[model samples]
Target: MIIESTWHKSSYSRAETNCLEAAYMTTGGAVVRDTQNRSLGYLEFSAMEWSAFLVEVKSCDL
Candidate 1:
């Protein structure tokens, strides 16, 4: 049930099995989901927002 979008694992995740996975939406948005369940609902973020969020995450502020 996995939709193909070139998902890349999160570098910050260190889980043994389940980690974070992300892909691009058709509308140019970002889709983030748990790797453990591809059928689960994903969280979508705008390009600008995703970029800011990443910065926050990288800075350990999130």
Candidate 2:
């Protein structure tokens, strides 16, 4: 099967010019890319790894 992803950015950064965009994979993982450099391609993460990364990000103050 073929799946397509829709890239989106955080609502908090909607007014910002520089930010990152992300899309979800059908396999339960995610893909991320820089808004300013789409030509550079993106980074893909496995489902497990993505979940861990999100947990860490939420735990941080940043």
Candidate 3:
């Protein structure tokens, strides 16, 4: 897979655990990956999916 060139670390990620990083792609949507092992490939999510995920995250339902 061709990784996006402008990937950025998410501010929500914990400085201690180093879990997730996210970035917007030129084609649209976004990419999400584990900061500790980015080479494993990332999971792509559409804008709607990401928005729903954020809502769930804010709800603390995890």
- Could you estimate the TM-score for every candidate? 0.68, 0.77, 0.65
Q: After superposition, how far is residue 57 of candidate 2 from its true place, in Å?
A: 0.9
Candidate 2 segments exceeding 4 Å error: 1-4, 11-17
Q: lDDT for every model?
A: 0.78, 0.79, 0.79
The digit string of per-residue lDDT tens for model 2 on 13-36 reads: 554586788888889988888887
Candidates sorted on lDDT, descending: 2, 3, 1
lDDT of 1 at 41: 75
Taking the tens digit of each residue's C-alpha lDDT, what string does model 3 give over 18-39?
7788887655567899998989
Tens digits of lDDT, candidate 1, 1-62: 33347988888677777689888766666889997777887888887888888799889997
Residue runs of model 1 more than 4 Å from their true location after superposition: 1-5, 15-18, 26-28
How does model 3 fare in lDDT?
Answer: 0.79
